[model samples]
Target: MSDKITFTLHELVSELDAQADELLKARHGITGSQFIALATLADVEPTDITDLARCLGVTKAAVSKRVPSLVKAGWVTTTHPPGQGRRVLLELTDSARDLVERAGRDLDEQFAALVDHPDASGIDLSALNDHLNTLTAIFRQKGPRA
Candidate 1:
């Protein structure tokens, strides 16, 4: 490979995301977005719909649409905060937790295989992760203009 960077950071990220999403969907029967939302909910005790939307990098409208389907599937539920008006918080149900756990195992196996590949010479994952973090911070700060 040439020393010159042929792909922009954004382009490389998009490509990786596409590949991961395709693989995850094919293997697990879950869309990338759904998996992300479910995973996020798995951590927090509960989250507001708006908060979940932000975490998922999607609009509240999109979250609204997705929540219903997740609710129908018995993977999530809405809870009202104590003494609060009917504004509801989102949370992953038991089934959602199990689903996310399975997905995590699958991702771990795939990641381990790549990291252990014999041909992965000169690959510095820690450094790459740091660089990507910087790039992501810069782009998030700049928004669409980035």
Candidate 2:
């Protein structure tokens, strides 16, 4: 067997995301974007779109695209406070929390099952996960290259 690793960084990311998408497909009809938005909504306090977008490391327009679907799906609600005027805030319903919990469980199982990789043996997945999480945080802070 060759000692060199064949997978590129992009391929690794793509495969990881593909696995997540497959898990989501088996249960939820919502897309990954929607899942992310839902999680953000569940975690963050009421704030304007700009702040939410910044916290999400995305543009307001990108967040906006998901709002309608979220609202229509009954996972979120938007409202303008008395003094807040046109500044709208988002809130996640109980349904969103339930979905997040279920998805979180699936993700936990999916990650735990990584140690059983077909081509990998005697791998320290916990250590790999910590490194991956750290790298992801660093890259997420940096954002995409223009």
Candidate 3:
């Protein structure tokens, strides 16, 4: 393990993302990117593509590209609200809500197993989560770095 905290955080995030992708693929037939987009939409539905892209820390074009597959898979639907002047809003379908809930339960189980393991003994998960959340807030406040 590297002594650099930033490097370790990067590596940990990458590994976690890969594992999540594999798990989601096996259980739900969705990629991690797709899952994230869906989850974000669940948190903030009736949002425009630009807002979704900002939430995902990606480009509007990237979110736009993913919309077709999600629509085809019956996970999302887009609509134009009155007076929006061509602005498109996205929302999760009923099926997508069910899928997100189930997937969230599965991920919770996986996380519980990991935290309950002997190797994780003595770790204060609540504190860790709080610190991570604080860090995330700080980063988000700062926006993207050059």
Q: Choose the strongest candidate by TM-score.
A: 3
Tens-digit lDDT string for candidate 1 (66-135): 8889999889998888987767798888888988999877875676578678898777777877997898
Tell me the lDDT of model 2 at 125: 76
What is the C-alpha local distance difference test score of each model?
0.79, 0.79, 0.91
lDDT of 3 by residue, 87-134 (tens): 899999999999999997897688778889898898787788899999
- Locate the minimum summed-lDDT window of 10 residues in model 2: 1-10
Order of quality (TM-score): 3, 2, 1
Candidate 2 lDDT: 0.79
The Cα error of candidate 3 at residue 43, in Å, is: 0.8
Candidate 2 lDDT, 55-115, residue by residue in tens: 7889999888878878898998889889876788888888888998889778778877876
Q: Residue pairs in steric clash, candidate 1? A: none
State which candidate, 1 or 3, has the greater lDDT. 3
The model with the greatest lDDT is 3
Clashing pairs for model 2 are: none
Estimated TM-score per prediction?
0.74, 0.76, 0.93
